[model samples]
Target: MKRSGPLLTLVAGLLFALFLLALNATTGTRGASSYGEESPAAPAAPASASPPATRTAPPPSQSPSPSTGPVPDAGYAGRTDDDSASVAVSLRDGRAIAYFCDGRNKESWLKGDVKADGTMKLTGRDGAELTGTLTAGERIRGTVDVGGARHGFTADKAVKPSGLYRATATVRGAKLVGGWIVLPSGRQVGILARDGKPSAAPAIDPSTGVVTVDGRRLTARPVAP
Candidate 1:
């Protein structure tokens, strides 16, 4: 009976040890599964988005324009359309003077102002009238009235020697008023009027503007209005 009791106790201890081993194996399996299911390391934070690109503008310009106006002083001389008369016009300090002559009995002296637009209207003795415009080419293009006649003409710009001249004096008992139109060709078309009677004028020293009328020396000066 004693031997039987000791054997039975040994059998019981072996059974208990087998049960503990089984429980430890189950716990190890559960721990491995938990580790595999852990959420994937949180996705790396997305890089911050970049700011939208911006634009800039440019600057402005600063400059001036040009000028357009009339000339201050000028002179012009030419002949009538019919070539029957010679005309001379002079401009000085905004004033204008014109002379018309056929170098015979027809003659007139006119005077007026040169307007801002380069136009002129002049009146003279015996109903004589002159109207003209100064062109961009510096030429005087217009019409003249003399002895009740209207004539068209274009006078070119005249330099120093090719201009108008006048001489006034009393010769031997008669009043002499002479006017000369010295042309660009050095030709002179003039008349010496004695007491209102017109006649051919003597030749003049153009450089000196000196003329001897009926043996009396006189200075024919440049005349302007």
Candidate 2:
């Protein structure tokens, strides 16, 4: 009976130890499963990173337009208030070249600076002066004074066939000068000078810039400034 009691006690102790080992294994498995779940949460960090890329997309929309400027670089032509003369102006790099003529014995080639505020004043030979404001990129309104005669004018933007031209040559010991302005509607006006004496000018070929005055052949070149 004593031996049997001790054996039973030993068996009870062995069973208790086995039960404790099983419980430890169960706890270890649960801890490993919890670590795996937390590792998957690390991928959620990349999902949060995606919003910064979206934030960078709005800057291009705030950029300025390519066409916006203080002045336009083109040609402008218009008639004077009296309808007896015409004017054309071309601008580039803040400088301007202009032509004024009556198509008969009255003309001037004016050159000057274009101010930041779209104002300009140009002077030429024979006491001619032009003062104007660039009302817009495509329009100008001003007055021109030639030999004490003042006239108001308005000019519109010129394109293609409507631009400025010039020709210069010494013919028979005389300094001959010619200036032409072609309107956008293909109408033309110009002036001719001989030894500083003005006269009615002639028509010019837009494609070749060729014209003849007083039987002299002259090549008129496009003037951008």
Candidate 3:
């Protein structure tokens, strides 16, 4: 009985030690090394980075002003003649910015690019601006700043309204005729294009085979009769 008692006590001591080791393992696993019971915390999401300079808003690019190079558009083919006037075009936002003209020669007209809001701008020949805008029907009223003085100029493209005339008047109705008709070139176009009146404007020149309305020669449209 005494021996059995010592053996049982030894067994009891061993079981107690084993129980303490198990408790310590479980506690550590929960706080630090507890693989089964603890979960790793998630890292915070990084902040959204701004776009690169190339992809982000960039500085506006400067477009070089147009020059007197070969005209790039067919719309200008017959706009002016060598002895006539020159016209220039400027573009601010792709549409006609401004138009400049000098009637004495073909080298005079100039144009610039227009802004999105119809504001026109350009680089001037003398490094200064000569700009204008049309306000009324055909009236172009604008200014060019010379040095520091503002010079205002007003002009209009002439248009002819019809006068009194009928289709039956072969030659005798000047007062009954409408206004004169001219061509785009120096040559005249249709004789009866005016108010169907017989015109005293000018006779068709047999030498040049060209017609005229009033005194100015026509140039664009073909003349009838």
Estimated TM-score for each candidate: 0.68, 0.65, 0.24
In model 1, the worst 10-residue window by lDDT is 62-71
Error of 2 at 29 (Å): 99
State the weakest 10-residue window (summed lDDT) of model 2: 39-48
lDDT (Cα, tens digit) per residue for candidate 3, span 93-208: 24442222332211112346543332344444544454544332233345544334444544333222111111222233442222122222433212233343222334344334
Candidate with maximal TM-score:
1
Please give the distance, in angstroms, between residue 126's alpha carbon in candidate 1 and its true position after superposition.
1.2
Which residue runs of candidate 3 sit more than 4 Å off their true CA positions?
Answer: 1-94, 97-109, 116-118, 145-150, 157-225
Candidate 3 accuracy as lDDT: 0.37
Please identify model 2 stretches exceeding 4 Å from their true place: 1-68, 214-216
**What would you estimate as the lDDT of candidate 1?**
0.86
Candidate 1 error regions (>4 Å): 1-68
- For model 1, residues 44-111, the per-residue Cα lDDT tens digits are 89999999988666666656432235545766788989998889998888899998878877788899
What lDDT does candidate 3 reach at residue 51? Answer: 86
Q: Candidate 3: lDDT of 13?
A: 100
- Would you list the C-alpha lDDT of every candidate in the order shown? 0.86, 0.85, 0.37
